[model samples]
Target: MNGGDVTEEAGEPVPESLWLATTSSTEYEPLPGDRRVDTAIVGGGIVGLTAAIRLKEAGHEVAVIETGRVVEGVTGHTTAKLTSQHGLRYDRLCSTFGREYARQYATANEAAIDAVERRVEEDGIECDFRRTEAYVYTESRSDGSDLLDETRAARRLGLPASYTETTPLPFDVEGAIRFDEQAEFHPRKYLLALAAAVDGDGSSVFETTRALDIDPGRQPRVTTDRGVVVADQVIVASHFPFFDRGGYFARVHPKRAYLLAVRISGEPPEGMFYSTATPPATIRGAPVDGERLLIVGGQGHEPGLDGPATSERYRRCEAFARERFEVESVEYRWSTHDLSPVDGVPFVGRLGPTTRNVYVGTGFDGWGMTGGIAAGTILADLIVNGSSPWADVFDPNRFTPAASAKALVEDNALVAARFLGDRIRTALAGSGTLPSPGEGTVVRQGGKPVAVSRGEDGELHAVSAVCPHMWCLVEWNDAERTWDCPCHGSRFDPDGTVRSGPALEDLTDRSG
Candidate 1:
């Protein structure tokens, strides 16, 4: 879910995820006082909610504690594409990994989609759930042949994927692969409806309850700011689990991607689109009261560092949309962040052997919707019964031999480079004053370091320059107008309210 509505200017379009615009709305009060349950699921996105619902159905008492409003994390901001095609993953999975493992991954995704269709039909969710053919196309000259390998691998895995030389897209593609029976939906709508459905009986959702940490053991304890939720099992469904026991911080890196919802005059094509190129564009359309919205996304990077180039990508996508369809207005614009595992598959299962009862789901690789649902099902099976056929595949304990080694060395080297580079830059600029206003700048004020932002309104806001979580200097995000810590991914509002965490406290007011 995109974090709850932050302050936006009047007459200016607010930044809301595409899923938020499409999902149904409701007013849900935050959780009050202490609570204990058979299961406590942290994070209120699709994964957490799905796990809570399944646990409740299995006759376990459940409570979902969310730091912000439900469906406001990455899920709400997603392109909301639910497909098994993750950009030529089949060929790589079969080659780098193994054929059987690749097949299992494909089968799990298919099962996830089927499960969602069944739930949507049985529960009658009004979230615009629809099945559409999904495509992965590329214009890159040398790599067009990879599509053929992907098609063969997919066929070997018993998937309904095929290679296609032609598509409805205006641009010419050397090649593309089509995956049948993939899906798309209004994510926030599905999540909120799921919350309402789970509200009765054994399950409930608690918003505005921040989880501080966990005390793990045979019966793990989840610690929240308000109170504790001691349970037989605890699922950390937060986009990145608050607890970093599984070395997830090193295993997966956080990346940001932008999305724009455009009103199109032409009828939307019958299929969903993705590309096999860097800074790729993923496009699809949804009907809203006789009109169609062209949802385009895909300039991804490490959150705050993309610089001016990121905004240009969004503009380029807008131009592409206009070239294809009569551009109506840009209805919504937002960005989302996700944790992508180094090995390209999600880490879903027990957090670690030492803490058997604690489960986590992360590193979706842009396939969160399907991966998250499958994760919930796997976790539910683990908690309720004992074993699942899919356990070993997604097990956190299973290590990737070469992938893990390269990830550890390369990620650490990158982090060190960033840390040292920031220090050098700060030292060279003696005063630490920023180059301009309306940009995030670190400056020394009255012998103290501070973070300063000059808003579009010309009002200046200042806070402690040091990040609350790790003391890294915070950078200004021009697009979102927030302070982002380049080191640990903690984010704060322009006025210093905590957005994403590891930083439980707000940035201290420097003006005072």
Candidate 2:
């Protein structure tokens, strides 16, 4: 198997649990008849629901239109560690940007965590919210001096953080950084309660209602396949925003990370843990009725590149977990896609200076728990009050010299590499089917390039391989079962219907 194929190999298979099991939660029912709102939130995830709740409390008529059930997107698969400690980010941010910018980021995240706690208490949500220490360690072979530097920076910013060496890990470490009073919890449970609250007076969440198109005029109008939502403001919180304002697709990169939920027969680790070293490993667990459920996460890659190696990543994590705790069975296996910003901080305000009514909050870089909440607050404040101090820091319009330059070079390079690779494969195949069964690519045949896939039933399905977005080549993402564009981050189903996009057109299934 190629290096990409090894990602799917699981060392110890875990029995599946129904926790966050995703089904067709998209609301396909007809949109609400002739309804208008003060704000229309286009996503039902943490950012959207949180914005809806806040807007309602502000006495504004709010409506949330979701393509699927609330929280079923990236939020459901999060590590659920509510910590401001995002790897070794602070030191890098303070150095590359400025101490002031770094402090703003730290403060925003800390405030977000406090907001979550206050919301939990106010709503009386039974989401198992608990204060725990969060640690980022490195293996003996790796250097985590950056983490120590960040801990110091965090302390300087008045965050409850410090440096440490001791950990409950199985192996020895160089050093570890710890943030005290950080948290962990059941994200879906908390979000479900938030959804319920948002469904109250002045706010309503409509699931299965996908916003097909959005126009940012004096008043924003979101057009779904069935109907339309007319509102004064719009928030694009759909993981990766459907619209590509400020060139977000190029300003950030998309990564797919895997997770394994293992139920161990032994005692649990004391605190939440992660590693800064390459091929990162994150471990966190909680005791449910005396049984410890260890959630192991890591093995991030550029979405479709490591499809074959999916299982091996999980196996390596399972072995690491087994060494420390008696792992019983792997209870859940899933993955999530997150956008990593060029700089460490997320883009959390207006889409761009030109688009006044259009706002966005994305590029969390795997710190979704805290970042999502912060995004909601910043985006909502911009929409309602027209001014926020935090908006200037995260404004998509403010150009980052280092970040934007790095993003342009890095993201474009990946797309070019994939394009050339596809061309080489096509030339080698010549005039025949290149039966690379598990791979998805464009092969030249019958004087045309075709998208070919070997179905599970041993059948060949071929269609036009050209992406509906800018005619880029499409790569098959085995983990998410979708065809993804490497260039601009649009995704499509096997028979495409705009699964995700900057492209509005769906893939026409030519599998005849």
Candidate 3:
């Protein structure tokens, strides 16, 4: 999945995120001990770091605790398009929410673009931030009609959108909705600068410190593996909220998407392009030491992958790239998961009814760059000014109609079925032990299902197959060599340490 799958193989492994592989790594030490700050942020992604800098500027001491390196999670693995046009989303927002609500959504995201530019200029972050246009196009004539509708709706909402019949792609598109003044950047480089701004100045950034739970109040206490952070407020920016008293698990569910960065013969497309046709693909380019790399992304599916095999996802995107562009070698490939909100809008305010000082910014769907930065502004404003004009649309307590609510329920049903049904199936034929090499599966050992895998070095490793999040039977992801929980998207490394969480505890080791 997006954030959890982080282990490099012994040799000849699929490359990790191009952003992480190319950028300079950070050096924030883990939380040393008890810390007292004005706010304690739980994740080190774009949303958390953005909020941290904003809070520190408002004279608030903030401490950001991360389970691993900052920006190396979901934020690093993204396509990195910093645009407000999220695949014809404005039309749906107007229909589901209304014109006014859609306007607020557009305003927050469009303003976030300017905010990022201002920070890059003021802080002098060399993140390859560039101005570009973003387009969502279709290859089919019928889908082009939908593009026209989106163009009109976006114009009504004051977005810089236009309908066009042409683009910079090598192939022809029936039509497209183009948004002007949108931008793309090196997300890790940009966030590292913000991370630097948050640290020092009496504020701190603590990496490799996992927050187990939060005791919320006016002076909220964040209990991490290292120590406790007592702060005036707690911000739950963790991609999947570890503490789920707000029932965020139900409201936001994870969907995994794959990306491949490949070298092309000629200069890549100059603008951000997303094809909304069959086998949807998002194409962009990144500068790597003067040569440009074409980024082909977007084959989103539920984490359980109840559909096609996971290995097929990477091939599909690569096929799309090779079909339209000049052939070269695929450089890097990785996958990521995002928590999509049942309602279109993300939750970006008070976390729950009882916890007033505890805040959250989650469920950006698959478009986090702008939504995440906008969350920082809304969250910071709520902490500093008591309210924000855009808070109503993203409030955690908004009403959910039964119709819109069914998507989440259906997603959960699949997860539940996978959990329960897999366990029963494993019980029927659980005699298999370890796979040959670079493979894993669940097998019966000592009356329990054990996740067994053999490394390329002929070494054996084993861990309990049960997931700690809700006792679901974990499935082996051969592509990542990790165990993924279908129930809630928590993932674990081969040796059983959590790579991602909703489950703070590791799997019970059975290797010995």
Candidate 4:
């Protein structure tokens, strides 16, 4: 395949998302020097860009600092389903957080959909935005009852939901919970417009500027690699808060999922659909040029856990697509990582009780489109009006020990066990021979675990295997060719550059 071909090739040379591949690239200069603004937004994804636009609209000077290009992170890689139907969530929310909180979750998500639609209209962003119905269905008879309960719960909470025995899917589902007037769009296109709107009027967007730390004070200072952003308030909108003072490492668990965009021979389904079954599947249609592509996703697992190879996950999605739909060719393949909150809801306000000036929005699980928008609105309201109606529910400091106790214990225990176990393995294995070209492995070097990779050109590259986030050993990801932290999902390049964070620093190079 040519380098520009959207289709998958033998070596998976183009790991770009469909949205990113189709959209035009835009770049912004890095932060020049120490600057001042009313708010400093770290990260330029859906949440940070939206928050910057909202804050600028509220007449506040805002600056958005991004380590990479805007919207190129998880936002660009998402399936872009703008629906409240998050895999039988209403029933669980009602059971776990009560009906009122469930109602708020529904309301907030619905409002977020409205906000996106309104923005597209008001800003004239031709991002292929469209309103469609969304369904959560299951093939298992036992899980059908949960769908029924969720339908009832959603309707009780005033959501536009209904229960049906049939759906637009090719397969016959046991039943489905359908939400009407939901939406989908090209996330990168929409977010790029938002990033554009965030510029001008005393506000700015800076790319390739990584934020190092937040100097908390009366005026919080966001220290960046190039300069500093002194502001009255700061929003940690990075997918995982880079500054981890709020203990987000324990509150959220990261999972990676694969997505494949394939040209289908048959007519694509009209509605967005998600499965409630184990090893969940999500199906939706995306219009690329004049053609509609079937976007099939979902084969989630913790990053760096060696099971089936990552390429195997993409193959699984392709196999599923071929089984259900008449697949012609896979147009694109990509992977994204999301943070799942222990409490089943995102944290979207102040970082903590004491850290009032710094706020964070994280743990959207796999439903960041609506969650990110809602978080941006909540953060904007809090920064401007000093409060929001939904503040208490999404407060980062709000403790619901009973709500997340099991998850908290289980997740952190896994982290601790993995950390100690990886160290023990490295210690026992001792130094070994270097990997062949186009491969990576961890070996003991100088009594320390060293991550070594041989590039395609046959040059050896080595770095410390220990993650800067919490000192957990990072395992090499064969599919993405990066070192992914099993603990908090921090990823680094083969030569030790930071790819994603919770870890602000690059891996220590030990190649020499």
How does each model score on lDDT?
A: 0.78, 0.74, 0.85, 0.87
Q: Where in model 1 is the C-alpha error above 4 Å?
A: 1-14, 22-26, 304-310, 323-325, 430-437, 445-449
Candidate 4 per-residue C-alpha lDDT over 1-512 given as tens digits, one digit per residue, 9 for 90 to 100: 00121233333425779999999877889999999999999999999998999999989999999998899888989999999888888878887887777887888889999999998998899999999999988888888777778889899999999999899998788988899999999999899988888888789999999999998888999999999899999999999999888899899988888888888887799999998866788899999889899888788887655567676777777767766777777778899789999988999999977787999999998998999999999999998998877766788887777678888898888777888889887888656577888788889988889999998899888999999888999987777888889888888999999988879899999978
Residue 442 Cα positional deviation in candidate 4, in Å, after optimal superposition: 1.1
Highest lDDT: give the candidate number: 4
Q: For residues 39-96, write the lDDT of model 3, one tens digit per residue.
A: 9999999899989999999999999999989998899899999999998788888888
Full-model lDDT, candidate 1: 0.78
Best model number under TM-score? 4
lDDT of 2 by residue, 1-512 (tens): 01122222345443332247522233324456556889989888888888888888888888888875778778877888899888878777777677788788888888888898998898788888889889988765447656667788888878888777888876677889888989988888888887877785757888777787888899889998658889988899887777766777667777767777877666568789988756678888854554667888777777535344544555556666666566667777777678887776788888878778888888898897888888888887877788766666677777778656776687778767766765665567654544355545557766656666665556666666677666776766554556777655677766566666555677766666
- At residue 432, candidate 1 shows an lDDT of 46
Ranking by TM-score: 4, 3, 1, 2
Error of 2 at 132 (Å): 0.5
TM-scores vs. true structure, each candidate: 0.93, 0.89, 0.95, 0.96
Better of 2 and 3 by lDDT: 3
Error of 4 at 336 (Å): 1.2
Cα error, residue 129 of model 4, in Å, equals: 0.6
Q: Residue 233: error of model 2 in Å?
A: 0.8
Per-residue lDDT of candidate 1, residues 143-251 (tens digit): 7678888899898999889988888877687888999989988777777878997776756788888998898887788888888888888999988777878877677
